[model samples]
Target: MLLPDLVRTAARRSPHAPAVRDGAATATYAELDALADRCAHALADLGVRPGDRVVLWTSKSIDTVAVMQAVLRLGAAYVPVAPSNPRPRVQCIADGCAARLVLADDDLAGLRTRPGQTLNDAAATPADCAFILYTSGSTGAPKGVSISHRNALSFVCWAAEETGLDASDRLANHAPFNFDLSVFDLYGAFLAGACVDLVPATLAFAPEALTRFLFEREITVWYSVPSALQLMTADGGLLDGDPPPALRVCVFAGEPFPIADVLRLRAAWPAVRLFNWYGPTETNVCTSYEVTAHDLTRTRPLPIGQACSGDQVWLDPPGADVGEIVVDGPTVMLGYWGQPAQDGPYRTGDFGRIGPDGNLEYVGRRDHMVKVRGHRVEPSEIEAVLATHPAVAAAAVVVVGAGLDSRIHAAVVPAGDARPTMLGLKAHCAAHLPTYMVVDAVRLVAELPRTANGKVDRAAVTALWAEAVVRG
Candidate 1:
């Protein structure tokens, strides 16, 4: 089925049901459908024909959601650009997609188009492009991932059924539209005939406020990166207060969740179902692991678990326990937008191993492993050890130089009233890590820099270290 059909089905099944909630405003299924129809007509009037690409440069709101569905309704794909993005980055995405039109907040002014005739739904097939999500390329260029209707449906359909979501459920959308995590938030809710509570970007860093919002909205389902959850639990007093009784399901992805933090969360919310989802933007949630009570005893990172329905995962180099992860399935993207389509399984640069229990264990990225003094070192290995420190809330390890001169630098966020000294952390590492694995420099910050998607901004952290060195 096409992507937009999900919304249409929900509208037909429960037209009066709440479909989306943005702050005090709520849109019913019927109202949302009508808004999407109107937006589609307006875009079509602007010459956005079938198969054309349109850039949605706006913040998270009811209007942005309408634009997304409207793009699909018109048989075209929408490329979402986060409103937080700089003008140059937005311009780069627009130029890359050769977008037919750019839709912004104020740009909708004077856009007066009566609802046009709805296009034949059958005209768009599962193979049609649904959206193009751009990844922050390490090479200073944005790479757009082209996802199709089939690609999205493969994950959405399974998630909706597996999680037992229904019209009574309310899903919390914490990720930005530009991020792939929002796909399941928007489409999965529609598929399940449920409502989605849109969490604005401004509330992302304010953990206390976000927690209050979640409880006030009575959100049933929650999904976001682990960092957000960590902040909520540690600084936001999520556990200090009464548990949110309405929260039933909690899903985390994008990066690894520290094992210690996971145990703490499990202790606090013993009844809530927790899941660790794993995937890249090219493939949305290829694998997931349900956190069991036994998992709390784990001293290492949680396993990524088995492949999701309609997806296939295999490690490169055949029988090796650890190797690059390769994914093949309907959920895999068609390819990078405007580039040649890739055949067969998409080889994710991430490395992982099959545990004895038949679950996948992620070992940092292949490229993230640096050779220091001819000894291979994974930054995650060091970071994991650092997180075990009682005083450290979060930690990241980065390589500072190249070849023999290369050195490991550590950045840490102190937990609660704990003021960890550089000498204290160094001594702690000396007891746990090898001499070579010990960090050469350490810096403490209130919090780590995060990308638009909420992952630790490694590049930004590296640059900050460089700036500190020059100043000293």
Candidate 2:
């Protein structure tokens, strides 16, 4: 089925049902369907055609979602860039993807209302490009990951089927449209004829606001990086004040969930099904692990589980303890936008191993290892051990310099009022990791910096550390 068909099918099944909610704004399936039609007319008037790529440089809103549907309805792919990006950056992405047009907030609002004809849905096949999602260019310029209709549906269909989502399920969309995590929010929810509550960027890091939204919105399924959940539970008293009876599933990806945090959460929300979805943006959730009670007992980080979305996942080098994760299947992207086509199995820069339970265990990213004092160091190894500390709600390790001059620095978010002293955290690392891996310095933060996708932003952390040193 075409990606746009999700909305059309859902609207036919329940036209009057609540389809999307953002702040006080809401749209029913019928309204969303009509708006998409009008928006499609607007795009068609602008010369958008099949196989063309348009950039939706707008914030997450009911309108933006409608625009996305409109783009698909025309058989034109949409390239998503963070709305916060400046004009130059957006234009760069637009130029990079060779976008036919770049639509901002004003375009759809003004044009959709004055649209003329009810444009027919484009004759798009499964292989047609659906959208281009750009990476959070922390290292350098953002590269768009070109996703096909088949590539996305492989995962969306799997998610809806696996979760048993239906009209009654209220899915919380925490990620921005530019993030791949939002695919399930838009398509998966629509595929299941479910309502998706759009959490605004304003509440992205506001733990208290996020905590309240969960309870008040009666979110049944939640998906985001682990850091957001950690913030909500730790500082916002997510579970302290009331019982969140409606929350049934919590899906996290983008980064590892500290084992200690998982145990605490599992104990609190015993009935809530937890899933650790694993994949980079290019592969859109190739593997998934349902959190078992047995997982809480294991000391290691959570296993990324077996392949899903009709994808085959394996560690390269076959029998090695850990190696780069590789994927070959429907969900793998066609290729980077404006780059060479992915010829075969995509070698994910991430490293992992098949655990004794036959699940894939994440062994940090291949790029995560660094040379500190000429000793190979995995910052995540230190971060993992630090996460085990009673007073540390979250922890991150970063290398501050180059070669022999490099220093390992740690940033921590303390658990509530019980802040772990720098010396105490260092000692904890010393006890758990090798001498070389022990951090040279530690800094406490209310929360760790997060990228647009919600993963801990290591470069931002490094910058913050460096800025402080310069000030000193």
lDDT of each: 0.88, 0.88
Which ranges of candidate 2 are over 4 A from the true structure?
A: 115-118, 137-139
Candidate 2: lDDT of 259? 91
Q: Name the 10 consecutive residues with the lowest summed lDDT in model 2.
A: 110-119
Taking the tens digit of each residue's C-alpha lDDT, what string does model 1 give over 265-314? 88788889899999999999999899978887787668999999589999
Candidate 2 Cα deviation (angstroms), residue 285: 0.3
Off by over 4 Å in 1: 109-122, 421-434
Pairs that collide, model 1: none
Error of 2 at 157 (Å): 0.6
